[model samples]
Target: MSCTETGAALHVEGLCWGPRPGLTLVDDIGFSIEAGSRLAILGPNGAGRTSLLRCLYRAVQPNAGRIAIDGVDLWSVSAREAAKTIAVVLQEMPGDFPFSVRDVVMMGRIPRREGLSGWSELDRERVAHALSHLDLAHLAGRQFATLSGGEKQRVLIARALAQEPRIIILDEPTNHLDIRHQLEILDLLRTLKLTIVSTLHDINLAAEFATDVAIITEGRLTAFGSPDAVLSPRELSAAFGVTATVHGAAASGGTRFSFSLPRQGSLS
Candidate 1:
């Protein structure tokens, strides 16, 4: 429950990844995330959002460019050191994991330097707080496989929270949830004072939750700025090839958007 009060800053420069030059999935991407800021990456399918994320978390090495975490080059750090600093919640989970929800959450503590002391009282307290924070206390004893998709997603997020990471990277954290749970999860993220970088399918959710937004398409970053500045009708039409109407978020004061397909034979 107790994380570093200040999150680490992230910087990326000319980040590219693929088996070879011509086949790059993420090309010439560059961005910076100030400490404790939330950034949402939006793009159409196969635009390489996930590929870019994989580079940040070091799932795959970038063929070119640099990734720096709080002024430290991420690739220069040991994998264990990086794990302690960054926690990620991906879209998929191991369906047949033979572990209880609490057990799975406890795994997050493995990255910390406990020095052979084994699971400590502090660890248990953190796990408990994460469970309650995610509204999973009653399901603590339930098997992970028995939970619904929404519940499973929440469990993954709880696990990430228990890690007490400086930065949390999520890939479509709202993928499986109903509207209520989606809002609930995003709300919980909003309360955390950590750096959050996520790939979101819903432009509305990004506008509501993110302080900054990056719009990428065809493996390139097209727009990056405040959600209000980046999520415009022009960017929407260019990135998605659809006609959209942009509006204010009403009482929430965030940006809102709606879209419609192009007219017949209008597709370029």
Candidate 2:
């Protein structure tokens, strides 16, 4: 795998979204991430982390705001054009598809297909590369539904990689994997040159994998910066209503964290 693709910069300003009037799932939010940066979104459940991601990937339209990719308005482009630039790996795995892993990965090339032509040589090459990149070459012949949970996740990621997008957005990419697979997946993601935006539940993992972090709560962005700067005990405690403690420096690659309920009468 080669890390040669230069990722695009992402910018969001005054973003808001909701299903109905007076109900906002993603409040006014603003942030910017440089090219090739990995951004981890963290917050308590229903804090709108996923909602914010949906807005960024154009899964759902924001009520108002601007989303720019490399200074180009994201909304100004067509869905097909956006698909060519942005790939998404959702948390929910698809239902048992009666297709082989290779077939599934080939679907990623749909956005790049020209007119009604068949799959081109470039599509096959990309699929093969994605399979090898994710270490799924041997499993390419296997039925996708028969694979284990971790394998399924890898296949989904490989599909995303086949899309050859400048930016990849994931909703809990490590959801079904065990500790080892989680670490492996995150390590692989760190090596990719693409811009990564993911919603992660593990604060420590986020600290380890993200080049930058954005903490969202109550549908608003409360903190955004390097893990060392934003993952402070104060911010964690305030955002999660827990006692947070940082145990190691990020530079050491051993930045551990511990969290516990606040003491009695602490909530006011």
Candidate 3:
């Protein structure tokens, strides 16, 4: 499957979500993801990142605000149509599935599937190509459960790529993977000219991988700009309760941030 060479615009305005009549988990949030650009949403745990992501991916409906994809309101888009355009590689990986690598990755082809048929030669080729990109071609027949955490992460990413999506939404894409795999995934994302919106735990990684950083604290956006402009020492201390120092990475041409010792009980 392929998308029109059109740019995918992910626009969100005044988006809000939560349960019951009160206690808003996310409130009056607004953001935009332009064509072929990447935005890394950064926040501490339970800072409404997951709630915001759920709204973005239509996992949950927002009580207020507009989320549009290429001028189409996200709520109006059919689930099947949304599946073809936006694919998510969520933070939580699926378990207890006794499927082979090929079988799992082939699920990406579900959008194009008609009723209850099987994979065609083209489908197999697409799966193979996806595996090859992640260097998992040889493990096509291997059990997904037997693979390492890093390998499973890559397989999940491959599945997302197999969808040929115009926009990719990831929730902490580097969570359980080792340093090497983390860098590899970020490197791949840097080269892909598709619109990407993701939640990230590592502020340093976001500094390197993201074209723009959106910092959220207590369910509100605090800062949004280029890494150097947004991830300041002051913001770092307040946002994550850390004293961070940013430095240049000569090899990747990206900035690296290091944290200093915290005061006994407070940030000074």
Candidate 4:
């Protein structure tokens, strides 16, 4: 698959993973995202959305298949090397850290720091830029644990930005935020230059935010393509086991969706 001319290209083929024998959580998933694109993975609970992301971000090694970043096998590179190109924002935040916000963001530079030399001018500059870009500069001195959910999420994203990676991977980025914060975070993601890969439960948000969408269910990829093609009523109904309807065109402002559970003992 061809990605955009900017950012990094990511390709996964025949990806499969599971904890041990006789069980598989991710099965033969394959897709590619070009640079500067957002790919949203959607599925019901326990449908392996998180497992797929874990494989992509190297949090867990796939039992089979290959992941290539910018045309190089991900496994061929060291963890430090991979960290230079891929940054990750997880769903959970650290319970408590005595460090201030600035200190938290500075940690992103750890991958780039040379042995025994400590942080350089570039590190400081990137951290400052990230803080300003995320509008967290005003809160830089605040204790991390004391911030609101939205602020904490932004801080985590700022930390990812400070890494200066070509691709950023997140798992359920909007999970715990309120409606306003959800939109804020998604809007922030749209402005970023990096390739974005994330899992979201909200189908409408995925439709609005993603350049491409992949639907996974039962550890398999059910659909993959532009949202217009992949997010049809049929696909949604099958993947989510709901009666799905699409309203409005993507070009006419935005596409919206509504879903209801299928009637018991009745096939429509």
Candidate 5:
């Protein structure tokens, strides 16, 4: 994704939302992301990481705030126009009927296509490129429903890649997967060179793969900065109420995060 370093590749200002009493789920939260930077949103469940993403994606409306891409307000354009730049991959890829892996990914092209010309040569080129980039070429002809958890996750990510979106939002992209596939997916994300914002359950993975990490606590953004700066022992313990240790990744020659046994309190 091409962008200017004017503060961030994506920007959010005064973003807040909730229902019923409509409590401020994300209170006055704001940040900027540079182009080609990766940010990992880390917190315990219900910390509002996903809610913040929904607001950015224009899925659920914020009670008040301005969300901008490059510098334009997202609400100023129609949903289709917004979609032309944003793509998302959630824990589950939602669809009712059967869809070929290739077909589902090609659907990403619809946003960029002009009227009824069908899939153009350029579109096919993009699909093939995304498949290869994602290492999903072998599964291109497979049915989406028949794939395992890890394969399905990668396919969803490939579909997002096919969109050529400027900003990619992934919520728990590694919900169910073996250790090897988990590392593979994380490594792939590290090399994408796009403006990526994702919510990850594994604090270690967040630290390892992200250039910057944000710690959201009780509906507010509590910490934001480089992994070494933010994911310290005190901060990790306070945020998740767990014991954790940060060290070198050993194999990758980078930060490696590990959890220590909790002394007390409910396991978060």
Candidate 6:
């Protein structure tokens, strides 16, 4: 509920990923996130945002490049150790398991254990804290499959918190939530004392929540910097193939934007 100590920094260099031999989905994209800073990855469909994120969390193998946390190579560590440092809340829902909400959240503690005997006192305390923080205490006993989309998203976030990670990676964490829930979730993420890297669909939400923004188009990074610097109309137009207008800055609040189709039918 209160602000915690700052988290680790993230560095990505020359990252590339692809399924086939010659076709790259994420092409030499690179960026860095300072400790406790929040970064929003923005791009149109097929822009490799998800692919780039997947490499960070080890969802897929990258053909080239490096990911480091606090100057340590991420892939060099064991998977369990990596889980301790980074937790992820992805877009897809878990399969319908007959687990209770508490059971689902307790899974996050698995990587913290040294042996598979039983839950430690620290694990219980973390689960309780995460549930209370995310407002899932009342629903702790409910079946996981019965919750609404917003509730489900919160539950997943609670699970991620239970991991006690230094960095949190989310892929479209606000997907399927109503406007109110979207704002609430983003607000919560922004306050956490952990490094945040998320892919966001709503440009306005990115403007509101991100300390830094990365714009990718056609598998390449076009921009990376403070939201105000990277989200200019020219960058937006180039990345999205649309004419864009900017109203204000996200850092000082009241930032607004509008978009329209380009009259020229081609980008020059």
Among these predictions, the greatest TM-score belongs to 2
lDDT (10s digit) by residue, model 5, range 18-113 = 864657777778888777788899998889899888898889888888888878888988887777678888876664539998998898888788
For model 5, the stretches where C-alpha displacement exceeds 4 angstroms are 1-8, 94-97, 247-254, 260-268
> Residue 40 deviation, candidate 4, in Å?
0.3
In candidate 3, which residue pairs get closer than 3 Å at backbone N, Cα or C atoms, i.e. clash?
Answer: none
Task: Flag the better candidate by lDDT, 5 or 6.
Answer: 6
Candidate 2 vs candidate 4: the TM-score winner is: 2
- Which scores greater on TM-score, model 5 or model 6? 6
Q: What TM-score quantifies how close candidate 4 is to the native fold? A: 0.96
How good is model 3 by TM-score?
A: 0.91
lDDT by residue for model 4 (1-268), tens: 1222246889999999999988999999999989889999999999999999899888999999999988899998888888888889999778688989999999998988999897899899999999999999999999999999999999999998998888999999999899999999999989898899999999999988999999999999999999999999999998888989888887895689999888986334
Which segments of candidate 3 are over 4 A away from where they belong?
5-7, 248-254, 261-268
TM-score (all chains, Cα) for each model? 0.93, 0.96, 0.91, 0.96, 0.89, 0.94
Residue 104 shift from truth in candidate 5, angstroms: 1.0
Q: Where does candidate 4 stray beyond 4 Å? A: 1-6, 266-268
Against the true structure, whose lDDT is highest? 2
Query: Residue-wise lDDT of candidate 3 within 1-268, one digit each (tens)?
Result: 2464344888889988887677888888887767887899998898999889888888988999999988888888788888888889998887777999988899998986778888878778878888998889999899999988888888888887777788888999899888998998888777666788899988878877887789888888888878778888789878988777767753567667888777788775
How do the residues 138-189 of candidate 6 rate in per-residue lDDT, one tens digit apiece? 9999999999888888899999999988888999999888999999999888
lDDT of each: 0.89, 0.92, 0.83, 0.91, 0.81, 0.89
Candidate 2 displacement at residue 133 in angstroms: 0.8
lDDT of residue 40 for candidate 5: 94
Stretches of candidate 1 off by over 4 Å are: 1-3, 113-117, 248-254, 264-268
How far in Å is the alpha carbon of 113 misplaced in model 4?
0.7
Model 1, 2-33: lDDT tens digits are: 24856789999999899676798999999998
- Least accurate 10 contiguous residues by lDDT in model 2: 1-10
